[model samples]
Target: MAPPSFVSQEEFHAFHTIDRKLYTLLVINLWRDPVESMQVIALWLWLERVGFKNVVQKILSLPYILTNELADEAVTCLNVINNDQLASLTEGNDTPLMQSLIDRDLSLQFFDKHRLIATQGITRIVNEVCIRALRDIMQHAIERNAAQSLADSQKVISHSLQQPMVQPGLPQVGFGPDADVELPWTQESEVPPDDRTMFVTFSKGYPVHEWEVREFFTRAYGDGIESLHMQEVPPDEQSLFARIVFCSESAIEIILSGMSKAKFTINGKHVWARKFVPKRLKPSLPAAPPVNLPV
Candidate 1:
């Protein structure tokens, strides 16, 4: 019998090859009881259709079936099932037993099975494609939000650096040499007064030495720093703090000018600097000499 017209030449050739093998096997057993041979052929055809339907269902159910092209390919592959060949196998048998085997409605069942499998396969492919598309959209949205957040943070930092620093309850004073400065007292005489010192703090978990501080300031301010001292930390503390004493008090003003917070990037670490402010001493209470008469 001729191959199905819907399939390609290559597909038809493959189908014809398999069909010839099956036909040869049936002819080999044709000399046996005719009724038993026909029954065997009917059973074989039913099993083949059932197995093909099962395999098609499994492949279509996979989540990776992401396009309509794949569904089209699956339908093309299924078209290789040629019912004409199956019908031809029972052509010469005119007995009532052979007619009974053909009339069992196997062709109707196969047609229904093929239509159902095709519908389910197309539905699964469409669903997987939609899911993947939504996943890509959500990923793009997350990346866009992250990029916007980064831009906003940079703008905030730039704006903050442009504004002048304001210390609450302290008068806004000029950095000029003639400006009157109130120097905060300190117990350590070796360290310069608060007006000439810049209190420096390093980012936690970074190792910093005195030489780095001296080198950083001398390079920036042209040898204006008088002394650099790294504070001795307690065993429990991990933070590093330093006292930078410049020869001229103007160095502190120059570094902190026009910025709300003086910050520097040293050796890829963030370091903050500010004019040193000491804790004020409270005034002494008046004597109770007026209460001597009552005693």
Candidate 2:
């Protein structure tokens, strides 16, 4: 009705025709091959980075897709299923993910016992089917995203290797043929290094700021950095030294190795990276050569 308010009767009819066709196409595809069609949809949404909340909003946007009150009900149902209180009610026996089914009233006995879940309009059997459907859909979305990412990465590497030579100024720098090399196999006695912090010494009079250095590391490694800071450098150095701490020691090895091998430069000056080693205190003098009173 709102759509009719905004457009001519003929135009509204034409739009409705196309909308029905879209629904038919979706249903037909699902009916023909459910798994593959679901996967195709999952991949598309995953690639587009569409979140569950966005889907809800999008549905509410289209009057033909969902009415106002129905949309509210849908949102209410989602809140009910994703409730944190449901997980708490289960005690430590269930994780948030496992408690999702319980919250949806998949179990009849559990549903009857819990007033919160039973009050929902859907019956236990319906809830059970809906919960399973949600899990399958989510699982497909996650798997497709991971698989697509891996395949895309491999394709990029393959394309780079096939290229005749690196570009002149914008050289693709790394470990070259050994770029994909892995760390040596671990032994039983060996443990990962605890320190992931690195000292980055920018060249004297470097034109870049401390944030730029942090951004560079983030681009090379990843986000979720513990801390990044710029401290006064030695008088001879002139420029500042950046201390970047990572959440894990593996981040240090991987990021630094990637940087060292790549030899990346900014503002026409090379940035130097090294492990942050603490200076050891010198041993105390041998009791001042025994000149004082001997105990």
Misplaced by over 4 Å in model 1 are 1-192, 234-239, 283-295
What's model 1's lDDT at 273?
70
Error of 1 at 177 (Å): 28
lDDT of 1 by residue, 90-165 (tens): 2221111111222332332353346555444433433432222222323333454455457668888997897778
Pairs that collide in candidate 2 are: none
Compared to the true structure, candidate 1 yields what TM-score?
Answer: 0.31
- The local lDDT score (0 to 100) that residue 257 gets in candidate 2 is 70
Report, for all candidates in order, the number of backbone clashes.
Answer: 0, 0
Q: Which residue pairs show backbone clashes in model 1?
A: none
Candidate 2 local lDDT, 237-274, one digit each (tens): 34335567777777777765744222347656666565
Runs in model 2 deviating more than 4 A are: 1-194, 233-238, 258-262, 282-295
TM-score computed on alpha carbons, candidate 2: 0.28
- Worst ten-residue run, lDDT, model 1? 286-295
